[model samples]
Target: MKEEEILPKLLSCFKETVEINQLIQKEINGKDIFDSYYESDLYKERIYKIQDLDTSIGILIGRLYKTSINLNYYYFDCPSQVYLNHIEEREKIYFDENIEADEKDFLLNEIQYFNNPEVNRSLDFGNFDCYSYGKYIDYEERFKITIRRKLEYLSQRLEKYNLTVDIQEETNIIDDNGNMIGYGTEAIVRTKIDKEIEPIETKSKNQLTANQIILLLQEIGFFIHPKIEDASKVKQAELISLITGLHQKNIKTNIQKLDKSVSENGANYQRDIDKINKILDDLV
Candidate 1:
């Protein structure tokens, strides 16, 4: 995938991780839930799903590291640091007198692999002893920390890009005759006037197929159960109704609370709200 595509895919993976983590937390740590819930089938199933997502995240991070290196981007340093840290851990393991002789020998033989240019470029650390056989829980905790730091850095950078785009869109105004009229607040006012007078398109039930509607709902952050995708039309329709109610209620609550002035990224908020509304209108 291209460098630009990796970031959005990573963000989606992060979102899935968060949702799954929340479910696990609620099941295991919620006020009324017992600690034994961790051993239940439901918890095991969610943990399996999360493990799959974590693997995907690792592969994506590797890909992102490769892309960053190819583009000579500064973000490459983050993954580089991860690799360096891993190598440091391996060195410590190699020197530790308590470790098995075979393990130290294995590390000594493959230590050059860690320094290989191809290995460095790929950033695939999954085969290392720490990841594959050693203290896995400790390795996983470190990996989670790495993911959190990268997510925070990427989110801040993405927010800056969005702010820059919003500012440019607000200031750069072109008239119907294809001439630049003005800039700044005056341009924003003209743009708002243009939008206010624009014709509204009516949505029809036939405009989007059932599958398309399902995809749109997913795009808007609604978690439609996978079984619904293969269910009967009646069942799918029922699921959609339930999701629509939840989505609309959330919008209603949040929209009322949003301040008219200096709202947190109002452009993105309105855009998502519009998408949900359009899907609702089409379904109607």
Candidate 2:
């Protein structure tokens, strides 16, 4: 299959897995029902089906990674590593005192032996059967959690390509006027810029002081990731270098768009084109 097709296929598989998990949760809502049906053929069949889907997802992820590498594209950390991080976080929560002892034990057991049931059985003299463990656990809830974590890991892997499979509802940002400005972190960044920065008129870009430039960039949400708490403390040369690098990145992105418009659409953007040429001339 083509690279573009893999994302859609992966998303479909995830959707099906989520639907099945929800159905299982609905069917086995109470503890007694979950314990009784945990070992039943129907429940086991669905579990195996989910496992199969997970295998398919893993294969697709590998293919996507290979394709990204071949294309020389940047990607986030490996899905396996993301999943491991999730497990580590859960383990930390399990160690907290607020969690009950029985709950902690169940979580610990699941964390350690989830992928190796045979090891669990061997170590516990065949007395640590998964079905028996279900008596103290909500099997369907655990299954749902596992599936959601898997989705999150896979989504993080695909994020660089802008192909995230959103499993939860997103929060929307509302302005003081009660208008929806945007959603998530992007909206927060936009609102920050709008509220904190007033428009300033400079005769030329070169006339703007280093401190002014730094403040402008900060307001425009440039120093967020690395987080420069005080741009004034940075050396003048270093601040200029940062501004130069940011300018180059912006130029590269906008120039590509300008090129596409001029060449393909034959758009008459001569005035803006001349402004870019003037900027380049000034640099020279």
Candidate 3:
């Protein structure tokens, strides 16, 4: 059953249990104070009613416990920590000296919603993402694809300007002892910016950043991923880093970690990774 349904039934059952218990106690007290005077037909009926109520209460209590366990499971399964962290980060944005009282009060109430499961559940409009708001928690696969496609789009753009792209990949054969023996014959795609394109046009009033250039290039008969475009600045940078081959540092300001690292350590090709890391880090 739904949590909303369970809660009200549990409350009604509890209230009835309290009322029935009071009646039973009152009858016992009257019988002790007035001897057999309390043994009327009405008194017998009340006693039977108490027994029936006790049985009903036992059943209700069992259902309550089961329903409670179900609710607890739902609560624990939710991405509460993710939402809490988001709220905490948002609230900390107001820690600066020039914060307004109204803004502070609004944030205070927003944070309280995370503490109340009923409020949070009430706001769950089918999309039960761990975070209460429209915050996304999983975009790793989307990021990877976005970066790869963007690089391909950039490569095509370079070709339009009479530039060539070279991409190469080689796999080293590892023997039983895990020592690199020989290189595979498979051809790897390579990328190289032409020296001729070093001074690309940048004087336009709406000149694109290096990353935006990559994104804009995809607009030529190619569509950019909406998620990537709609993503936060930090996410965009991380996606760019993944595609261009760079180590993505966690977003320190927002306290969100990009747990996946696309960097190659102790690899022969460090130049591209290093160059991309520098370019993206500057923007990040």
Candidate 4:
């Protein structure tokens, strides 16, 4: 598309994304849940409880990445299937189906924490639910938000070219002017603004397909090793070995050091794919 058309649409999309960013920022400003009458042993108990839950979530395979999830976060870290099973056993319903708003808010709070732009402390909670809000900027949530904003911008911009362009492949509807309309209670109310527009077959350079991303991660040398039952169990020695290899090659990957915090959330979060991939790779 021409710059004249693309820029304005891009600006519009970015404008909308500001709302999302603000929401995220607001969420991060909230306090940690473990701030209650916290004690050391109690904290350890909570960690193990979550890890046991993670063990189960970690067993299931991920549809998108074909790996175990990190059920500790009880949000994105859990495996889909195992977590689904865990949820079924605990809540008797899926998260999206019957979860209470308060409970969901609580869970999403943790998700938001783990997904915080600054998630460095998340994996290293050290007997506490460690978290950071916006400084890390290296976590998956930031990556997703960044990519989505860009897509929205490009999609809006492309319409100026009189082209039917959408950044998201799953996008089903678009107005004639090429702006995006959100979902509704029933059939989404939308009107086409263009009389006729040609669709673009080209993919965006920055956007990575699910499979492409998986392949790229593999190329970065994040493969499964079955020698250890749990990644978390890796003592200083294993940590040194695994991290050394990755650091030498300049790549980042999580080492679970398996510990069963199965009573935790991700087991039933219904798609903690990342954790599942990490765990199941060895089991399989």
Clashing pairs in 1: none
Q: Residue 43 in model 1: shift from native, Å?
A: 0.7
Question: How many backbone clashes does every candidate have?
Answer: 0, 0, 7, 41
- On a 0 to 100 scale, what is the lDDT of residue 56 in model 1? 77
Which digits, one per residue and each the tens of the lDDT, describe model 2 over residues 98-184? 465544353434332332322221101123321111111122333335434654554454444443333321212233443333221
Those runs of model 1 whose alpha carbons end farther than 4 Å from true positions after fitting are 30-36, 69-73, 76-284
- What local lDDT does model 1 show for residue 213? 44
TM-score of 2: 0.27
TM-score of 3: 0.22
- What is the lDDT of every predicted structure here? 0.43, 0.43, 0.39, 0.33
Question: What are the runs in model 2 whose C-alpha is more than 4 Å off?
Answer: 31-34, 69-75, 78-284
Clashing pairs in 3: 166-190, 166-191, 167-189, 167-190, 167-191, 168-189, 168-190
TM agreement with the true structure for every prediction: 0.27, 0.27, 0.22, 0.19
Off by more than 4 A, model 3: 1-3, 24-34, 73-284
**TM-score of model 1 relative to the true fold?**
0.27
Candidate 4 residue lDDT tens string, 122-237: 22224443332222122244334433443343334334444322233311122334222311000111113532342223445444333233333444454444533234422422
Worst 10 residues of 3 by lDDT: 249-258
